[model samples]
Target: MTSTAPAQEWPADVRTLAIDVGGSGFKAAILDPAGAMLTERVRVETPYPCPPERLMSSVVDLTQDLGHRDRVSVGFPGLVRNGKVRNIPSLSRTAYDGDTDPALEDAWRGFDLAGALTEAFGVPTKVANDADVQGCAVVSGEGFEFVMTLGTGVGTALFLDGRLLPHIEGGHAPFRKGDTFEEQLGNVARKQIGNERWARRVVEAITAYDRFLFFDTIHVGGGNAKHLDPADLPHKARIVANTAGIIGGVRLWDLDA
Candidate 1:
């Protein structure tokens, strides 16, 4: 996202409900116009076979006790364009480690998540890829910046001079051993391989990513990011807090985030 328009000004009274949808859980919090948390974060375990309707209800349930929200911002794990969903690796599965469900796959295609949430909340809503939303919180507005979020699956986002580039599901791209990045580096892979080996794989993945993109810095976030040891990663790489998903929600309204 790049901005040509002037910055938007939210009235001090506006409260934003920011939701972070992950494979393992759904988390949300109310944010002041300035992005400070206005209420303690609320969370719910994400149910398996989570079709769009179920996911929508989960989001609504999170805000039941948080009072009124002037708008909504969502960080979705799937590929979203124009507020619609595309590929849904996490949500398409029947179980956490199960194979994709064809029925779920068809249901998610072009689902209007932003529109649905807008109507549900009775407010304007914006949705973007989870990694893109997380990247919005961490980028330095310098040269090329990249974010890699390791969760149930992997998520990727890119930015240049503070402007977001288009989204890419880089984790699904080929890596080695006839496996893709998500196949080799996701949470399931980490459990199968152990953190020691997973850390090694992470370094290797970052190295390969650097070779391909040569980012100014690679910020790693998501639930699984804590497993990595900074000493093993390239000097330019840094691990960021998982809370960025919620903290970055306010930026979603900005023209360039």
Candidate 2:
């Protein structure tokens, strides 16, 4: 089920189609090997009960007209390992913010997402945890760099001296008050608490992570990151734009190589 588009000129020899699959939306753009976007990003509202095939179709529709793509890169919001979906917090639910469905959860587990996408798009494909892909674009490759994406739920990635570390669903780890970080700092919390206090909580989360990880630098980026107060951010931390998810797609191949 390939989506076709009129061929457009690409500035670089390799044309990478970057897809950022968020819980709320799916965004896509074409990028040069250098990681600069060649097409304006296209986005679509995410569908509920999105099994693996439905998500892939949506992605194909979202990127069909962006331009010709030589390769596909997906930034999926989940724990992906070796092209398989180990766990996906959002799409496995019966509905957005709804209870999880055991059937849906079973469908998503062990799904060969990258292979399915490669077959659908008829191009080579790679899938990584959304935060890991975002981190690829922002990390300086210095010592102990960490990334936390604040959105539908928290997502995290870590690096050591420029080498990508194994992916961990750190957002699901227990934080304060016996609640996971996602329960406290996710979008719902941000909306309910309002940005001012939410921003403070964000700072607090980073502070707690700093104490635990002792990271040399921490980068925060996501759809909701724009609402944060810059002054509240720690000196060792900085905010990056959500576009990092798309731009980092090109860099992901480099990490693999």
Candidate 3:
């Protein structure tokens, strides 16, 4: 769904608390209704064995000093459905091998994240996949657009004329050598293989997606985007600011409402 607000009528005084939950970090900021951050963002490293309670506590601590907001919006790095966290891929047991904490991982499954945050912060809240939220900040409202975030893992979002489509876990889909896009292109992979080799994989990823999706434009964002060379990207693809994660949060409320 797309925002109904007219281009010139964006309510300037409406403030929102925008939260971005990633595998490696959690960040929160106060944002103007138009999606620009109004205050310095606060962030903390995501705790390992992040059960729902631990995550919630960290989020609460991160936002404690951000001041008041009329509403809350969250962009989470997982599969969210109807405001609940359906799955947390990066935090799952399979992702950790022997270090896995089954109980903690299970606690995240089906957690009503939006509801919990709303109750804890005393505001209306909305939630969506992190990439879908980022798409809200960057989609140009022309033809088809595809967004990819390469951070702790890969995230994909698609939009048509600025309307976000249903999220697809394309990051988990096989890309090459039986490894998923996340497996081959995430921060872990980049660090493992060195920037030069990782850059090559990113180029390959862009070409592969362009061939299959044929998107008119591709926007790449996330912490790792800074490491990529613009020259290596396709003409249609460009790097976007990491702040898109927080900026896109406000738009999520528009979709939910």
Best by TM-score: 1
How many clashes would you count in candidate 2? Answer: 0
TM-score of each: 0.95, 0.94, 0.91
With candidate 3 superimposed using the best TM-score fit, by how many Å does residue 188's alpha carbon deviate from the native? 1.3
So what's the TM-score on candidate 3? 0.91
Give a tens-digit lDDT track for model 1, residues 41-129: 99999998899999988888778899888778889998988778889899999998899999999999988888788888887788888
- Badly placed stretches (over 4 Å) of model 1 are 1-9
For residues 1-257, write the lDDT of model 3, one tens digit per residue: 22222223335698889898888889989998778889998989878767788778999889988897877778888888877777777765433322446776688877888778878888667778899999999888899999999998899999998888888888888899999998899887898899999989998999888878999999999999999999888899999999999998877766534
In candidate 2, how many Å is residue 55 off? 0.4
Q: What lDDT would candidate 1 get against the real structure?
A: 0.87
Could you give candidate 2's per-residue lDDT for residues 51-169 as a string of tens digits? 98899889888888887889888899999877788999889886778877889899999998877888899977888899999999999987999999999999999999888889999
Which pairs clash inside model 1?
none
The runs of at least 3 residues in candidate 2 whose Cα sits more than 4 Å from the true structure, single-residue gaps closed, are 1-12
Pitting candidate 1 against candidate 3, the one with the higher TM-score is 1
Q: Give residue 95's error in model 1 in angstroms.
A: 0.9
How do all the candidates rank in terms of lDDT, highest first?
A: 2, 1, 3
